[model samples]
Target: MIQALVIDDQEINCILVKGLLENFFPDRIRPYATSNLAEALELITTLQPELLFLDISMPEMDGFELLQHVRKQQKAEVIFVTAHDAFALDAFDHQAIGYITKPIVSEKFVRTVSRAIELIHQKTNTGLVETLKKAIITSGNNQDKRITLTSQKGLTFVDPAHILYCESSGNYTTFFLVNREQIVVSKQIGSFVSKLESHSIIRVHDRYLVNLQHVTSYIRGNGGLLVLINGKEVPVSVRRKNDLLHFFDE
Candidate 1:
């Protein structure tokens, strides 16, 4: 069975999360719910659950505080559930397995939990450092200046300037770089789009994130295709064609 813990000051939220876990995993999951951070910390140390569902807003000890404490004690999978969208970026910065918004939909909740489970299994089998590096590299923006990538070998810090573009393959994202190296990370194109918005990278298609710096020319074909420095052609979405042209013009 997969042991889980729910930490929320509000009883309703705790119950809601517990119910979802029970429904999703049935007999394979056991959950411990608590309102107090102190009690939660104790349970976390002793129980060492495979997953933790946490709330960002709480009296005395906030979600970030609890996360820091957990990091100090042990490395357990964490998914933060919060009402405030403002905390989403911060939650990602802390390497949270997932950041779920309030009034969680059953589908999204189950998906997030499943993702956490997969990540936990991967970390347990491979190692934590490798997983963390891959997450940082895939989630970083070119303007971020730095990123991290992980593998069975070890973690590698990457300079975003070296990245050429990112492509999505099924459930994975592959990063193409200037030096002819590629880094495959476990993330969707949409997630990378949001994180790399401030950088030179733009979503040219549903499956491609192109770096404006590497774009040499755009061929106006049936829809459109962007030609990169390495002679690779990437499709441009019809909806974003005009916007891409305007961005280049500016």
Candidate 2:
């Protein structure tokens, strides 16, 4: 049986999806539903379901925030369920395999769920399994401090060590990693600097947040640039040059 968990602020939405699972996949899926985020989180921790149907907009905790916690603890494949498609881009950025728009279409839900099942069987989800594993430790007094980044499909949990650099434009930030690949999220560079300050990540320019661990060589001059181990050149702002030097020297 496929363990499935459905979370939505609306009780009706939860009921509707659960009903669909029962009627269509009665033998295949064993589903559980909750309209409360707190209760949902607890169930997720205890049940450790293989599939998640999460709503984006909620009262106190949105799906994105809850996902940080979910991705931290479990290896469930997520499918975002929402009333509108406004956050579709953000959903995809987070690595969600499917996006089910509300007033739920039977065909789309079934198709997406089928795809989720197909992907769940693939080689333990490859890089994502290890990525999430290192990024989120759900043990006693969790030790590793990892950053949860928004991806093209869902929220991506990243170990600070895996990051190469971040380039931002307008309201979006694109993360370039050393191992997996590049993921573009909707947040700007300013939002990430605070989260990464303790780590080796530093904002060298308005457009860049480069991981100091990945800096292979620093080419100096007026507004000098850095060469990352991944072969990418990131520019260092004139104003932040002194700060970078202090950080390195320290």
Candidate 3:
């Protein structure tokens, strides 16, 4: 049986998380629930569970403080369950498996739990984990300058300038970088449209978002295609051709 622990200051929240996990997650989650930080710390020491559900804010001791203490003594992947959306980016900084926003919607809860399970099964690579920890800590100073992507493994730091293009395939979105590296995310393409648009990345087609800075040439005819600096040809819908040209003229 896989061990799981839920730490929340509110008794009801702790119980609710525990119940949700038991129902949505497979029977593998053998849950241990606690509201007291002292008791929770003791349980972490004793149980050393493989997974943890943490709340960021608590009386006397907060979630980040608890995480710091527990991480030093044990290695458990955490999925933060908090009422505040502000901590979501902070959660990625700590290489958390996932973040659940306030009021606890069941569908969102299940989605986060599903991602956590993927992390458990994938066995996060050490190099990538280290990269993420460093990226997260350093990211606070560069929030306005850089964008970070959080996934099952960890966080990836991306410079909008180095991005070549983004491609969508169903639920997955792939980021192609200037260094020839690709960061494949499990989120939908539209999810990233807003975050990247301001950086000069524009949607060329439903399946493609190309960085305007990386467009080397445009191959015309048959709806045409964009040749990126990296040599990848991203399609352009004929209807969007005028918009693409208008963007260039701006």
Candidate 4:
């Protein structure tokens, strides 16, 4: 069972989160909630929970302020719950697992919590490792040469030339190679864009980060489709279509 905690200023909000956890997770998660920040701080130290559902609009110190205190005790997968969308970027900056807006929609809550659980599994189990795990990169003469991919099993050094494309699922990115080998890493596709951009890797879609070196053909459409060297077809989003075309033109 996973130990989880919910901290909210409103008693009703705390109850709602606790209820939702019980309904969705049932036997998987053992949840505790508190409306008092002081009590919540004590609980963080005492429980040392693996999952935390924190509210951002609490009195005195908000969720972000509380996170500063919580981090000192232990590392927990934090999902920020708030009615304000304004803090979404800040929450992501703090590396929170998920940011949930107020008046919790069950479907959205389930989806967000499901992702948090997946990340937790990745951290605790041998799944995808930690999402913040660094990808050591080597670049020479202003060119990216290699990327070190780390996994629970071991580390694998990959050459940019050999990479075909990368696909993103939630927080994980899977690198597909020319040899049909796949390396899964616990990092977002956006994290790798700057590192691999010099080596002809680019984001063609929200879910796809591709190495343009391996693109064999481009089939035109609204955003169009890309035919890779290995005969894999990848979608090109309309937003990034012009950028891709410009790359091709160059």
Each model's lDDT comes to 0.83, 0.85, 0.84, 0.86
Residue-level lDDT of model 1, residues 1-250, one tens digit each, is 7789999999899999998888888865798898887889899999988888999999978999988988897777889998988998899898898989998988898888887776765566456655655665688845235665553335456666677899998878888999998888776778777667677888988899998888899999765999999999999989989989899889
Q: For candidate 4, give the lDDT of residue 132.
A: 20
Error of 3 at 190 (Å): 24
lDDT of 4 by residue, 1-250 (tens): 8899999999999999999999999977899999997899899988999999989987889889899888988889899999999999999999998988887899999998888886776666543323223222222232224566865456676888899999999988999998999998887889899888888988999999888888889999999999999999999999999999998888
**Candidate 4 Cα outliers beyond 4 Å, as residue runs:** 127-250
Clash count, candidate 2: 15
Scored against the true structure, residue 5 in model 4 reaches a CA lDDT of 98
* Number of the top TM-score candidate: 4
TM-score of 1: 0.52
lDDT at position 172, candidate 2: 83
TM-score of 3: 0.50
- Give the poorly placed runs of model 1, Cα more than 4 Å off: 127-250
> How many pairs of residues collide in each model?
2, 15, 0, 0
**Sorted by TM-score, highest first, which candidate order results?**
4, 1, 3, 2
